[model samples]
Target: MNLIEQLKTILSEEQVTTNDVILEQHSHDESYHTPHLPDVVVFPNTTEEVSKVLQFANDNKIPVVPFGLGSSLEGHVVPEYGGISLDMSQMNQVLEIRNQDFLVRVQPGVTRTQVNKELNKHGLFFSVDPGADATLGGMAATNASGTTSVRYGIMRDQVRDLEVVLADGTVIHTGGLSAKSSSGLHLNGLMVGSEGTLGIITELTLRVFGIPEKITAARATFPTIQNAVDAVVAVMSAGIPMARIELVDTRSIQQVNTSLETTFEEAPTLFLEFHGSEAALQYDVAFTQDILKDYNCMNFAFEQDSKARNALWELRHNLAYSFIHSAPGKKLMVTDASVPINELPSAILHSRAKIEEMNLDAAIVGHVGDGNYHVLMMIDLSNPYEIEQAKILNEHIVNFALSKGGTCTGEHGVGIGKAKYQALEHGAAYEVMKSIKKTLDPNNILNPGKIFRDINE
Candidate 1:
């Protein structure tokens, strides 16, 4: 039987589809990388189904690309080899909520928002919010984190265990429900950020957190990027418990105000959040304000009410969408990099200088507390000059971060976009990674063309 006929035999005809619309949707993620449609898309409803599909593909030597919500910033979900795009959306379910243990076991298709909605009913919440309402499985695959990562940590920290399917369709469980263990290999960590090259995640046992007693938000505008970054360093040095610390450049602030019609100052600004008792929040705010004053802080707006605090974060979170809204037809060429905390000021400075030199239309924003940031630009894909300029600016920013002994990618995984930097950033360690990949996936049928590149091993 042909591949489509075999898929239909394994699953109902309605579950396995060759429709062009669905194929196009699974072709690429949110990245600007070129898209290629998969030959077939299969919706798997359980771990057994996923295993059977993998076993079949392993036997036939067909590539298998797992699909989530298609919200990734990198081209992590793009099917470059045009095989089966295993759509995991059919497996969405919150299997168990161990409220007393502060943990939850969910299917790979469960989204961050959906888990939070369930957790909220028990007066608990998930800590890692990557801005997009992405699936928890996708977040684990990329080891993603965002605003809350400055406090609660990234996806790797949240994953207590995972139910994974091996390349040969063998099912295995990694880790357990305990808080910590010294039993054996840390397979959970290894699989969390593998980008589907190592194994496919079937179910995730994640740790959740209780809602804070009091949550407050604030905006601090600075005269320059250096001042804003220095202020962030001060907060960390002082050991202030910050929930989040984000930076938006003056141009980005202007774009936000223009797109959202808010009256925020068009200056280098910091959007901060604090989670603690009301009194503690006030004390931290006062101490943070004092530090900012030394750095020429132009404005400080303290938001204590929940509505106002949400509005402040909404403004910061919507900055990228603002650029998209203002320019209807242009493609967004977004890229991200990370650096050590002390090196953040220089990194942003170098990036700004290059952006100004290239005269590219762009905005700068970041999770400044963690020394991670992004460059948001609307590009014309048809213009080779524009594409080349974007690549140059991205490389310049990545090089600056790498020179500081940091990574080419911080939160976003090394998809096709950042695959070329693996050898440059990792050196000999990159080879070890390739060896591991080739060992786990001998046929290289799982998510081909990711992380490592140009390997003939």
Candidate 2:
């Protein structure tokens, strides 16, 4: 029997497929990176089954690319090499909810939104939004964070444990369910951002938060991008806890107005959220507004009702899709870079200036509270000049961040998109990472094209 028949023995024949439509869907993520089809796609319902498939793939030297919902922004799920696309969607399940412990154990396929839905009954919620309704496993793989991450933290911070299936099909738990431990290597940290280049995560135990006594959402418009970013820095320095603080540039605001049919001001703005007791939240809002005055905040508005607040954020979240909708037949190229809180002003200003210099149509949006921002640019794939401009712009942003002692990618993990910068960004540590890859996945079959192309390269 061939690999397809062999895989069928491990799973139902219906679970192992070579359907053209499925292969096409699994080929790439929401990235401008080129995609390639896997030879087959296999749906594994359990960790044991995932282990079996990995064992078979490893022994036979077939590449196995672990895939979740494919909501990745950096080509994390793209099958760059022809082999098995290990689809984990069938494994979706909320295994356990330890209410008192403020934790939940879930299959890798469980999405962030799904976890939140389940936790809502217990008055709990997962904080790492990542904008996309992405699988928790995929979010962990990318170490994703979104608006609320300014206070709630990233996927890496929320993961208490991970059940990882190794390249040789050996299953291991990388961490304990306890609150804290220093007993072994920080494997949870190591695995969370591995982007499936290290091993396949079959399950995860994550931390959750109780709903705050009060939640408020607000928008602050600034006279200039520099003023907006500077105001964010001031808010941070004031030591008032902010649940979410996002920067949306004038261009992005324009897109939002067009897409959402709202008549908000087209200027640099901050989407703000405060979570705490009613009294404490009021204090945070007052103090934040006080600081914004020093930086020329143009206008301020807030939403208190849950439905209204959700709608406000929904508009911000859809800005990327709005850009796509406006640009006919154009793909998006997002530049990700993070710098120190103090350097954010210079970084964002320089980015805006550079885009204008290149005469590129782009908008700026970011988790400004974390000193991370993105340049959203539309590209025509058929136009070589447009493609080259995107590459040059991305590299420029990455280089600027590196010069300021920031990361090439703050939340988006280093999949194939950021692989080239790994060596330069990590320097000697990059070699250590390669060594770990060689030691853990000697065959290089676990998402082979990610992190970096090869140790030699």
Candidate 3:
């Protein structure tokens, strides 16, 4: 039988498709990276089905790229050397909710928003929100982090265990339900950020948090980007337990105001959130305000009303879309980098300078609390000159962060876009990673051309 026919036997015929529209949908993610269509797409509904599909693919030496919602900023799901695009959406289910243990078990296809909606019934939430309603499995695959990551930790921290299917169809559990362990090698950490290169995650057990008694959101504007970033350093230095601290530069705010029709101050702004008891939140807000005063804060206000607080975050979360909306017929190349808190100011300033020097239209925004920032650069993909300039600016920003002992990508995984930097970023460690990849996937039939490029290329 042919590939499509063979896959249909593993899944129902309705679950396998070669429709042009479906192929197009699976070809790319929300990235500027080039896309390639898979020869066929398969939707497996159970762990056994996934195992069977992988067994067949491994025996035949066919590449299989597991796909989620395709909301990734990098081209993590592009199916570069496509044979099968394994769509996990059909398996999405909240299998179990362990409220007493603050844990949840879910299939690989569950999304962050979907998980939170179910968790909210028990006064719990999944905190590693990466701007998109990304699938929990994809979030784990990328080790994604967002605004809350500064306080709650990243995706790897929340993952308690994973039910993974290896390239050769062997099933393994990377961790357990215990709060901590030293039993064996740390496979959970390895698989969480492997980007589907080593294996496919069939299910996940994640840690969740109870809803706080009180929540407060605040916004502060500064005279300049330097002052706003300095204020972030000050707030972190004070050891204030901030749930979220995001920085939006003046250009980004302008785009937001223009796109959303809100009258936010056109200055560098810090969006802050705190979660705790009412008294504790009040004290933290007051203390944070006092620290901002020393950094030339122009305006500081606490959003007390729930609607207003939500609205404030809505604007911040939609900043990237605003930039996209403003620039018609252009693609976005977002550069992610992280430095130590002390080096954040220089890193951000250097990024802003490079953007200006290249004469490109870009904006600086980030989850500044954890020293990670992104430059949203709009580019005309068809224009070679524009693409080259964007690349140059990105290299400058990444090189600067690397010099300061930061990462090429803080949250966005090393998909095709950042693959070139893996050797530079990891040095001798890169060779170790290559050995691991080879050992697990000898045929290179799983998400080829991700995290590390072919030596010849």
Candidate 4:
């Protein structure tokens, strides 16, 4: 029997879908890469069902793509090759909350916000807050980080353990709750950012943190992007222990003001947050203001009330949407790259020059704490010239970042868009990755044509 018939025999008909509409919807993610519909889409409610499906696909030499809510910036979920798309949405369940250990166990489909809501009841919270309400599985797959990452670290840091299913449908647990260990191979680290090319994640146990006794947010404005980034570097260098440090260029500030229907200065801005006891947070914010003044900051203000802080951050968090609102019928093209702290000034300036040279409309924003920033370019994809210009500009940006001991992609994984540049960036390390992929997935049926092509073949 064919794979579909065999799968239907094992799972309920309602769980398996061959309908074209569903297939098309499951094909691509929130990326500009071309999409190809999967041959079938299946929603598995349990780990056993997922393993069974994987075993069937392995037997049939069918590719399996693990899909979340399809909010990925890269083409991670696009099923370029016809095969089974494993939708993990139905696996959205919070299995347990270990409040004492400051940890939580959840099915792969649980989202960051969902976990936060549950943890709030215990006066605890998960730190990894990628702006989008992305699934835990998707966040793990991409090693996603966001504004709060400056303080709490990335998604990988929060994950204490993962229940992974191998390409052959064998189950394995990666790590444990021990705070530190010189254990066996670092399987947890390996699985956290594998992008589903290595194994499928079934369950995740993540570390959490106690809610801060006090939290404060600030909005600081600078005359230019350089001043803003310089102040960010100074703050970090001074060991301020900021919970969040984000830079929004003047252009982005203007866009946000228009898009959000609020009036703010049309100058480069910094959104800062501090979390700690009342005494410590007070010292941090006061010192931060002094540091910004050294950089010639024009206007600086902070919000301590939770409601005001939420409104302030809500504006900063939705910077991506500002691009969408600015250009109603355009697709948003984002480039996330990181450079050395000192090199950031030159990098940002060069990008601005490129935008002007190309006569393009774009804005720059970044998690400046880590020297990671994105160039959000609104493009009318229908225009051939505009598409070509974007490609050229993006290529230049990636090359510049690499030249400065930086990566072509910071948060976005190598999902087809950046695949071609892997060899150029990794050199000898690229071959090692290919070898690893081959050892883990000999058939190349899992997320094929990504990261590295089969070199032996």
lDDT by residue (tens digit), candidate 3, 1-457: 8898888888899999999999999999989999899999999999999999999999999999999999888899999888999999988999999999999999999999999999999999999979888999999999999999999999999999999999999999999999999899999999999999999999999999999999999899999899999999999999999999999999998898789888889999999999999999989999999999999999998898899998988888888888888889999889899999999999999898888877788999999999999999889999999999988988898899999999999999889999989899999999999999999988888898888677324
User: TM-score for all predictions?
Assistant: 0.98, 0.99, 0.99, 0.98
Error of 3 at 197 (Å): 0.3
Candidate 4 local Cα displacement, residue 220, angstroms = 0.5
Q: Candidate 3 has which clashing residue pairs, if any?
A: none
Q: Note the Cα lDDT for every prediction shown.
A: 0.91, 0.91, 0.93, 0.88
Winner on lDDT between 1 and 3 is 3
Q: Model 4: clashing residue pairs?
A: none
Point out where model 4 deviates above 4 Å: 453-457
Q: Looking at model 4, which ten-residue stretch has the lowest summed lDDT?
A: 448-457
Q: Write the per-residue lDDT of candidate 4 for residues 1-457, one digit (tens) a residue.
A: 7778888987888999999889989988877778889989999999888888888888778989999999888789998887989999999999999999888999999988998999999999989877889999999988999899888998889989999988888888999887778989889898887899998999999999999999999899998888888898899989999999998888888888788878999999899999999999889989999999999999998798999999988888798887887787788888888898888889988998999998988889888788888998888889888888888998999999999999998888888888878889999998888888889888777777666654456
User: Model 2 over residues 1-457: C-alpha lDDT tens digits?
Assistant: 8999999998899999999999999999988889899999999999889999989999999999988888788888888878999999998999999999999999989998898899999999999988889999888888999888999888899999999999999999999889999797999999999999889999999999999999999999988998999899989998989999999999998888887788999999999999999889888899888999899988989899999999989988888889988988899888789999999999999999999999988898999999999999999999999999989989999999999999999988788889899989999998999999999999889898888786545
Looking at model 1, the pairs that clash are: none
